[model samples]
Structure formats: C-alpha cells, structure tokens
Target: MQNRRLFLGSVAATAAVAGLSACTSMGGFSLTEAVRRLLQLSANRAFDRLLQPEGFWDDQVTRLALPDMVGNGRGDVLARILTGPMFKDRLAHAFNRTAARAARNAAPAVAEAVRGIGIRNALALLHGRPDEATTYLRGEMAGRLIDVMLPEFGDALHTASDPLIGEVMAALTGVNTAALANDLAVKADDAIWRAIGQEEAAIRADPRSTNDPVLIGALSVR
Candidate 1:
C-alpha cells in the first residue's frame, strides 16, 4: 500500500511536467502553460530557498522546535530539564535538516498538482488577489505533501542523532516512533507552505516580473 502511494505520487509529479510539455508544444502562451510555469516556478523556488540546511534553519519563521509540554506533568518536568534553548535549537536544526533532505522527493508531487489547474481556474487565479496562487497551492498540495513527507520524515528521524531528545519524549510523554514521524511530517508541510507563501509574495511585488512567460500567458487568458 505504501509503495503504491509513493508510486502514484511520482506519477502525479511526472504528469505535471507532462502537462507543461504539452502546453509548451501548443506554441503560444496559453493559460494552462502560464499556470504550469507559475506553479513550477513557485515549487522550485521554495525548494531552493527553504529546503536547505542553511536555508531552512536560517528562516526563523519556519524553524520549529518540539512541542512545549509546559504543563503536562512529566512532560513538563522533562521540558524544564531540557532547559536552555541550545538543546532545543540543536533539535530544531536536526529536524529541519531532515526536512530539507526529504523535500527533494516532493518535486514530482508538486508538479503533478501544477498540472491539475484548469484553464478556467487559471483565469480566475490570474485575476484574483495577490496571494491567490499561494492559497490555492496550500489547499491543493498540503494533503498530498503530507503523504509524500511521512516516509521521509520517518527515515530521517530514525537516522537522526537525537537519542536524548527521543529518549526524554518517550520516557515522559510516551511519544512512540509513529507519533514523532507524524509530527515531523506535519512540521515539514507547514514549512513548505510558509516558503511557498513567501515566494508568492515576492512574485506579487516584482513589477518587472510581468514579463515572465507564465505571467504573460496567465494574463492573456481573458
């Protein structure tokens, strides 16, 4: 079942690029191609900017720590013992490093979704408010990304050198491997969304960006 899902995810990604090829072959800037380019651009930009150890960790907004168990009995006690931000910072760094590594695998899934945009949808998006693309992407891609991220998160967690963090959490909060895996996957997804949103904002701000083929095609849709 897992293998099937992963296979399907890869297929979706391939399909996205296929859509791009098909549109490009049509020879003129069409709305579909525009949307494809925008989505592809956004995804590539996000990965490049946010899916690196330095990139992911440097962005204070996306760098996340383990959940604070401030009032949860033994969990709280352990949290206190963990104390200083350095340990948490190290843990966050490791978590982000894992996410960065796994993000490379998400390209296919992202591309597949870009292909899913319809002409009508593209027109709407072209005319919509500034952040519409980002919002649409979040809606369309989050669940798929979660499915894609889980296995990577699990593998990273297993290989990550954080025995003390894991030991404390397991001893105090009874967080087994599966729970940790899910948490990490969710965090990675959130980070991706944030990165995409940031890129979208940049796209909106650049007036010179109007010359981009995707933007040109999108605007011509009407």
Candidate 2:
C-alpha cells in the first residue's frame, strides 16, 4: 500500500509533464485535466507493478506491517504486545497479507474512478484554485471510493481467519484511511505550489514558457 502511494506520487510527477504540454497546447489547462492525467499515469504504473511476481508480496515498501505505535505515540499497549513473544510476527504478517489483498481488490475501482475523474472534472479543476481543485476531486469521489473499497477491504479482513489478525487489520485500516486523507491534503497543497513554482521558474529561466495558461491561471489566483 505504501508502494502504491509512492507509485501514485511518481506517476503524478511524470504526468505533470504531459499535463504541462497539454495545457500549453490548449492555451489554458483545467485542474481537472491535470488531476485526471495524474491518475491515468499513476494507474498505469500501478498496474504494471502489480503484474510483477513480487508486486505486492515481495516489495518491502508495499508489504504491510504493524503501525509504529511507539513513534506515533499510540500507547504502550501495542508496544508491550510487540515486545512480547509469539504474536509479533503473526501480527505483522497478517496485516501485510490483508493489505496486499486489499490493494489488489481496490485497484480496479481506483482505476475506473480515476478515469472518470479525467472525463468528468478535468476542465472544472483546471479553472479552480489549488485547494479548491483538490477539494472538488475528493468530494466528488471519496464517498464512492469508500463505498467501493471498504467492502473489499472488509471482505479481505474477514477471510484472514485469525481473530487477532482481524483486530490488527481493523486498526490498520482506520489508520491508513486517515493517513491517506491527510497525505492527499498535503499533496494537493504541494501540487498547487509545485505547479505554480515550476511554471514561474521556467518562465524566469527560459522566458519561452511564459504566457501559458497553467501559469496564467496560477498567477491569476493571487
């Protein structure tokens, strides 16, 4: 799952180039188009990675593990248990297995929704503020994602067969969902600035990239 996020980030970065090109040609780009392109790029990369043998299982980053209860300041309950014998490995393995399965199940819907984002909101997003664009996409699709993914994750958890493992998975799911949401918020802000900063820097550096719609739109914001 971590790997999935990483892969998504990378793809978004890559997509920025294509988006810039598209925006340049279009005279003005839509934030929706930018995000849709990001999603499309990310999904393609994720699908490629997942098709690999070690895709979800062998990748250390994607391979799930117990939440770091210590650094995260959760409490001693998890620490005490982790320090104890027997259950630690079991707990870790169970969570990873569940997360891997959930990623597999959730991939399709995510891809579909991302594509939908391309078609539905790309134009509107391009015209909106950075945070507004992010909020729009999240509001439009988060509930749909939760509805689709939660059930799949729940099913995967149910099949785990270990009661303790299930408990850990439940905890992990809650943690991951919150983390993902927070991360997206940060990414949205970062992406906004990145888009603006990069464009400004390019204009200063090359002078030819000036007058582009993306740059114009961003500059118009404030």
Candidate 3:
C-alpha cells in the first residue's frame, strides 16, 4: 500500500512538473515551443494511459467492434459472421483487448508525430481552440499508425482468438486483419487525443497545478 501511494505521488509530481514546464519560457523557451512540447507530453501521456487493458475496455468512446462492410460480397459475409449480435459482443471485447495489448508498441509512432511538429505549426496550434492540437496530431499520425501498429495488432490478434473467431477466420481467410488494424489505429489515436485534450484543459484552467517556476514564469508572459 505504501509503495502504491509512493508511486501515485511520484506520478502526480511528474504531472505537476510537466504542467509547470508547459507554461514557462526560461532557458530559451518560446511559448510556441513550450506548447509543442506540452502537446507531445500530453499525447504520449494519453497513449500511456488509454492503451492499457482497462483503458480500451472501460472507455465507451473507444470500444471496438467488428468492421462494418457496406457492399463487398466476401467482406460483407465475413463481417456478418463476425458481427452477428450474439457473437459480436464477445468479439468486440476481445478486439479491444488486443488493441490494449498492442498499445505499448505504438510509442515510437507517437514520438515520431511529436518530432514532426514544426515551429510555425506549433505556434498555430498553441493559439488554436482546445481540440485543434489533437486534430492536427490525428492527421499527422493517422497514416503512420497503420504502419507502426499493424504488426503489434497482428501479434495481439493471434493471442486473442476464440474458437469461433478462429474457425471463421480460417474458413473465410483473415482479410479482416487489415480492417482491424485500421480501425484500431483510428480509435486508439482518438482516445490518445481525448486524453491530451483533457489534460490541456485541466492545466489551462488551473494555475497551481505545478511548481516549476520556469513554466509558471513563461505562462505569465503569455
């Protein structure tokens, strides 16, 4: 219990420091630059939290379902087989769990998106509305997500199979892999952005959230 408390306390301390750091301009800090760093921090933190097993399972907004096929014949048949209401609930749950398992492996992709942020773009995002940064990140990271997360998702999917899922995929062929990968990437990215936006809102609303004098000083100037 004491160890758990210490861990929580350390996490809180880190968040406070990050919040303060986001606001400050000392050591050649530009507000725009600080905001970019903050966005990256927020995005990474979001993925860290939301990619956990519970994060994907418990969050309604991010819950996964079997892909919906509009018209492709084989795909449609496959989708129906996988998504029949009775079968779908279990499959969806398993699908989300697979995504959760693959979450840790996605850090590099997230980091790359952060690194791609330019100074001009940072300035624009810093001054934009609450969800703008997240939107920008979604666009920037969307394509890369499939590349980064596909292998991890595939690995997780191998472990997540049930008898029904296994039988269907074997008979139908596992073309759903591409669809699942794309869906997981999109949903996971959205969940990450939501987490970042929430953190950003909290920090913007509260001045005493962190103790970093440098960050606080920088925030005061802007």
Candidate 4:
C-alpha cells in the first residue's frame, strides 16, 4: 500500500499531461482512476490510523462502549444493567482491543470491497461532499463489511477476552452469542468506516498534502 501511495504521487506529478478531461473524468483524469485512488487512499489511511491501540480506545467518535452492553442503539436497558460495570469494562476493553486488531486484519476486506464498488456516476461523486467516497462505500458494503469481519472479529474477541468472555457470556443468560458477536462486528466496522470517512474528508480538504496525483487533480476541480 505504501508503494502504491508513492506510485500515485508520481502519477499526480504527470496529471496535467496524463489525459484529456471528459464527462467521466475529473480535470483530465479518468474519474474511474481518480476514484480508485481516492477510495484506496482513504481506506488505507483510515485503517492504518485506527490500527493503533488508541484507534478505538481513545477516539471519542469511534470508541465502542457497547454502552448498551447488548442492544447498543438497539435499546436493551436490561442487558446493560445485567452486564454490570465489571462486565461492561471487560467487554469494552476486549472489544476495543479486538477492534484494533480487526482494523488491521480487515484491510484486505476493505480494499476488496472498495475495488468491487463500481462508480457509475463518477463525476457526481467526485463533486459531491468531502467524504462522498466514504459515503458511497458505506452504502455499498457497510453491511457486507460487517459480514466479512464478523467471524474474524468474533474469533479475536474470544481470543482477546477469553476467560472473561466465557464467564460473562455463560452468566449472561438471554443474551444471544450471535447477537453479541454481531454487535461487536457492527461496532468495529462502524468505527473503521467513521475513521475512513474522516481521512477522506481530510484528503479532500487538502488534496495537495496527500501528494497523490489523482486526488489533487480530481479534488482541485471546482
């Protein structure tokens, strides 16, 4: 990915002479090509940024409280109380720890999903919101992303929290194992996307800083 990023920097250097602008292109750059870098850059930076230990644990926006303990955003107050502070702390710690690992492990999945999303109206997206690429990605595979990472996220959660997870899950009756895992997966994926979107916005705001030709050419357009 670092090599590809450097290659893109070289590509940007030749932007003015690379190609002719067209309906489907941005500032003489193929919208397809530009979108590819835009998405790739965003996904790569996002995952790399969040892959650190502080990624989820420290980020106020992406932190996973599992605050609900079971039905976060699903409204399960009983689940929260039943889980208690010790359980909540353990689960949150475990979730955050595994979330960081998942961010790294799920990079390919993110890249594959980004590659699979065919940008139909390329120009529209190019001129859309700063995080438009990320919005498009969220719509395309947010759910699918959860599906792809769930198994791995679940496995990591088990490995990270093990005995505590076993004890908690065994004691927390009425809490479906699958649902809890799904919640963890959803939280992790959401955090990743949020981080990715932020990176996309940052690049769009200052494309020149990225030193990537495609983004510079594409976003520089009015």
Output the number of the TM-score-best candidate. Answer: 4
Q: lDDT by residue for model 3 over 1-222, one digit each (tens)?
A: 999999998897666445544643356555555565566656665676666777776876566555553123265545675555666676566667777766666666677667766545554555466556667776766566556666766665455355655644554554566675676666665555567777665554553565544334433433
| Position 130, candidate 2: lDDT | 35
- Candidate 4: tens digits of C-alpha lDDT, residues 35-136: 878888988888777888777887887888763555342324446534567757766776787778766667887788777778887767877887888889
Candidate 1's displacement at residue 170, Å, is 5.7
Deviation in Å, model 2, residue 70 alpha carbon? 14
Model 1 — which ten-residue stretch has the worst lDDT?
Answer: 64-73
* Candidate 1 local lDDT, residue 207: 27
RMSD of 2: 14.2
Q: In candidate 2, how many Å is residue 29 off? A: 10
In candidate 3, position 188 carries an lDDT of 62
Q: List ranges where model 3 is wrong by over 4 Å.
A: 1-27, 69-86, 156-164, 171-176, 210-222
| Model 1 RMSD vs true structure | 13.1
The candidate with the higher lDDT, 1 or 4, is 4
The model with the greatest lDDT is 4
lDDT of 1 by residue, 1-222 (tens): 999999998897666445444666235555556666766776778888766667678887677557543223275556664577776566666677777776777767787787775445665665566667767876866577878878987775565456654545455555466667777778777888777767666665662474685564344333
Candidate 4 Cα outliers beyond 4 Å, as residue runs: 1-20, 23-29, 67-87, 156-161
TM-score of each: 0.72, 0.41, 0.66, 0.76
